[model samples]
Target chain A: MPYVNIRITREGATAEQKATLIQGVTQLLADVLNKNPETTVVVIDEVDTDNWGIGGKSVTVRRKQGK
Target chain B: MPYVNIRITREGATAEQKATLIQGVTQLLADVLNKNPETTVVVIDEVDTDNWGIGGKSVTVRRKQGK
Candidate 1:
């Protein structure tokens, strides 16, 4: 069983969109990796700005400072 | 290019253990799927008791009710 984990930026995508994305991923894994969707697990995490970092900066602070 | 999403039990693992698990998963994906670790993204999500389900029931409620 292949378990897929998706860490999404908070407020980037709606819950419905996330669910659909997971379903699409599920299909991709099944078709591409020859895995079983029943056994495949997909988790989408919403990371807060402080919890996420990019370009050596905290997303929360950068956004607040309008950088 | 392969993204792996792992939805973990909220309290089932410690942060260190989770990190190790992610590393292990990264290795496995590289070996089995021939994916690159740098490009492979693994996301582990800790779910609250009320949010998880199994065996047609909520894991949180079942644990609380001791069922």
Candidate 2:
């Protein structure tokens, strides 16, 4: 059995949207890889922009700079 | 920091393709959300056809049925 775990930052996702997104992604994986929906898990991590950074830049700063 | 983890079933990805996919995904996250590339992690799980199922149906069976 293949176990796929996804932990994504919850940026603009509303509660309903988050649920649907998880469901959609789960369905996509299940459909494409023939994995059991029960075994596939998707996790969301809601973090502050200050806490998340990429390439040595903070998300908040990046957004402000538009880069 | 927001942590995003992805575990995907390796289908047709060559070794180089897999590396590039990881790099691209990491870069995408970094570029979009300003996340540190060092913390972004992507895992790949190569599973047999029988181990993965979606919607209560085996992937291989689904493929056979043209679903």
RMSD of each: 8.7, 7.5
Determine which window of 10 residues in candidate 1 chain A has minimal summed lDDT. A14-23
Local distance difference test scores for all models: 0.69, 0.62
lDDT of 1 by residue, B1-67 (tens): 7788776668768888989978999999999989999988889867754434332234454576685
DockQ-derived CAPRI band for the predicted complex in model 1: incorrect
Q: Which candidate is the best by TM-score?
A: 1
Off by over 4 Å in 2: A1-43, A47-67, B1-4
**Residues A1-67 of candidate 1: C-alpha lDDT, one tens digit per residue:** 6656567668667544655666677788878988876666665567788998888889987888786
Interface DockQ per candidate: 0.07, 0.22
Please, what are the lDDT tens digits per residue for candidate 2 over residues B1-67? Answer: 3344545544564677557546655665565556678777876656555666877987788779985
Worst-scoring 10-residue span by lDDT in model 2 chain A: A1-10
